[model samples]
Target: MARIAFILLCHKNPDAIIRQAEQLTAAGDCIAVHFDASADAADYNAILNGLQDNPNVTFAKKRVKCGWGEWSLVQATLNAVEAAVEAFPHASHFYMVSGDCMPIKSAGFAHQFLDAHDCDFIESYDFFDSNWIKTGFREERLIYRHFFNERTQKRRFYWGLALQQRLGLRRKIPEDLQIMIGSQWWCLRRRTIEALLDFVQERRDVMRFFQRTWIPDETFFQTLVRHLVPGREIECRTLTFLMFTDYGMPVTFYNDHYDLLLGQDALFARKISVEASQLHERLGGLYASDQMEFEISNEGRTLFQFLTGRGRVGRRFAQRFWEQETTLGRNRELMIIACKKWHVAKRLVAGIRDHTNVPAVEYLFNEEDAALPDLGGIETTLEKRSRHRRALMRMIFDHFESDRLIICLDPSSLDLMSDFFADRATVRLLEISCSFDDDYLAGHARRVGLAGPQTGADTMARLLPTIRHDMVYERDMMRDADFPNMTRISDTGSVDANAHAIAQFLGVSLETGKTLAETPHLFVD
Candidate 1:
């Protein structure tokens, strides 16, 4: 068991601070708390009383009156380290977090991940580069003098710092030292923390220089580490996901951010508030688990699964497919179910239905297809792979029973259509793309990892001629006038929106200018 020493730098959210402290406190993984001295004394004493009985939890003896962009924040972090070192000397790693930050990954997974790779997880970027953030953030933070004290209301800003920089009044950096900037939150080795403590003690001048600097917390420790090591990228990116506002302050998260939280691979997220207490509660339960089932499942989750879940994407596609099949399938002439180019299929079905109405369409992909993606590399057994394909065939055929059947297919869908559907029916391939240029199709194709322009063009050349005898409609979405007596449609606009010439091809006519908002879908099957 590789136990960690966790330090929390907290200022607000008393309930969140108490919960996180209790959650991270375990037998081997010790937790140390440092509530800002500026906070209410009663709140501080209440937290101390709550955690005092827990041997694994400790409190900072020297609480710093922390303020944003001030030295106090860094001082508080340093004090938390001193608290942790004293309480748990056998700790494997030292990690800093905030009161608002809640773990996304389980602590067991975190311990395993840290134990597997003995590398530092710190994010540091050069002051000279604009690659990480906008240039203005750097200029104001690094170039000029900045001083602010929230408690005492002391403030100072001097443009002379820039002029002095022009006249070379800047303090000389030793050739061995270089500056780097990064997020204040960091996880480091025992040796690294010791080294930083020693460096600060020895170089009071260097620490004082940073004291007058703007937002010193972000720059102080990161710059010192880079100055000491001089030219190596951070081994691990910071695990916390801090949503930033337009003003660059950390944005508070809520329930609306729950999906975004799921998508992120981070262990922790920041700036949570009372409004999103439900999010915090959910995250708390998740972090306590020993293993993450979703991590393994997420890798194999494909577009098919997302499509079937009737999520936002699935609902959009369902609504579009329904507009046509709702009317046309009832005629019993011939219906093709193709989802190879899912995005194009949506547009084509929606656009075609605008002019040609169809019956309620029924397309079925089972729980397995809707659950897993194309597992070409994953499922390598003939028996398993064969079974997977058959499952999909069963799903496709279960819907339409007719001699006339041509389904849209992708590499993930199936390899051979002749096996299940029977080749008796003449297959009329209706290939629809926004344009011959992959850039047009890329918006949709890229999601499934089939966005290569040159590759798509090459496939078109081979497949179109191979089935030349039965090919019916081979039209590039915006390029060709293959639909005689109809105007060409632009790929950029939505077909339902009456995209001028594009809508004309679909034969969608409104009452003068009422648009899709009024007539929407004209019934025609």
Candidate 2:
């Protein structure tokens, strides 16, 4: 069995840190903690007192005051690693993680996997060749010297870089060194750690060069590991599961993320919220197990889909950057069901979802209305809600990347309805006028606060003919002069029958198992 030593770097939440230490130490693994020097003294002392009885837990001799994108973070990590190495010489592997990290699997599983594979698990990508750095200065991170804290003093930091750029002041990277960067967390073999320490002791100039570079913790060890170990022995990936936003901020895990995290292939997960006491309590049971191998139920497919890129935003809404009509083309197959009745419209959305693979959305407009709730506290401009509805539609169309998008519109979305009808080449417009049924018309009028059922019927009869529609669904036969294309649909028909009529018009097929109407909360009114 491979013995593992954990290096935990922390700044706050002493109680949670203590809980983590207890769990790891109980698993027959040793841990070394480095508390940030700037943190409260009470927090540090509390951690010490809590773990004082455990022989497996130790603390760094000195704490370094850490900051985001600064050299201090790397220094604190070094202190913790050194402490772990000195305290646990029998440890065959060293895993560096944050204090917020928790194991998803038993410690035995991690040890067994490490023992089975002799390769080092760390994400190392060539700095210039890869697009890992998304938000900030990419190439400049290596050439230009960064002195200011980028997060705290944003203006001065940029100003400093700008001044350097103007002066043509650039530092030459250490010769013969292939620069690499990746996630800060890593699990390295004992031999790799020894080799890395030896290189650091001999290369003070290289150390000084990285000291002034941006976010050195993410680059320092990652760059050095390439030269220290053989390429075949490196796995080029981390064992810890970490997620970040487009802005490069870590996404904190919560209590409800148990399934998402546990199903992942990763042995450990990081950036957990301190207040996630229930998650902490649940994960506390995963320790000191004799079971060596466990099956990963999800294998991380669903988790990554949710955490990466534009997909991070849920289906109902998308990022503001993606709220554009850039992908709209003549090849698009989109259908707009301009229906106002909540009861009938919901079943239609559900039926379409159950029978067809096409993505169907209910109340694509009027999200702010009672049927569908708005994104909490998302303030919008004073412009008409139609503009907002159009933007959301464009985002969904772009993000979904499907052959067809079936949308249900609200009573108030006339402007949106008109906009889609004008685009005859791309959109297939379907109008469900008040002729569907007397009950439906009455319900729609009452729900929308119209004057009367006849008033609602008259409004649709007068306005719908002016708009171009490929098809109209009605319960009673309409005058051929008004509806050139008509499909008689019984309001009393089965949901499947209504779904089949819709599928037939779109040249698609329907299945019966899963439906969108089941998730009524996701649909906006």
User: Where does candidate 1 have its weakest 10-residue lDDT segment?
Assistant: 310-319
lDDT of 2 by residue, 332-449 (tens): 6677665545556666666666566778777645544423324332313223334455444555666676757877765344445445544432665454443334444444434443
The number of the candidate with the highest lDDT is 2
Q: Give the per-residue lDDT digits (tens) of candidate 1, residues 1-525.
A: 567888888876676677777787742478889999999988888888877788988888999888777888888888888888878888878888877787777787878777876756677777667366564445555444555553355432344544666777555444455666778777777767777888989988787677767677777777776655534434636767665544666667786655445445566777677677789888777667775543221211232232232212211112222122222222223333333344454444554545445321222231123223344433334345344543433333334443223233431332232233222222222323233333324433444432223333443343333222111122222123232233322234354443454333333454321242223332111
Q: Judged by lDDT against the true structure, how good is candidate 2?
A: 0.69
Give the TM-score (vs. native) of candidate 2: 0.63
* Total backbone collisions for each predicted model: 13, 4
**TM-scores for every predicted model:** 0.57, 0.63
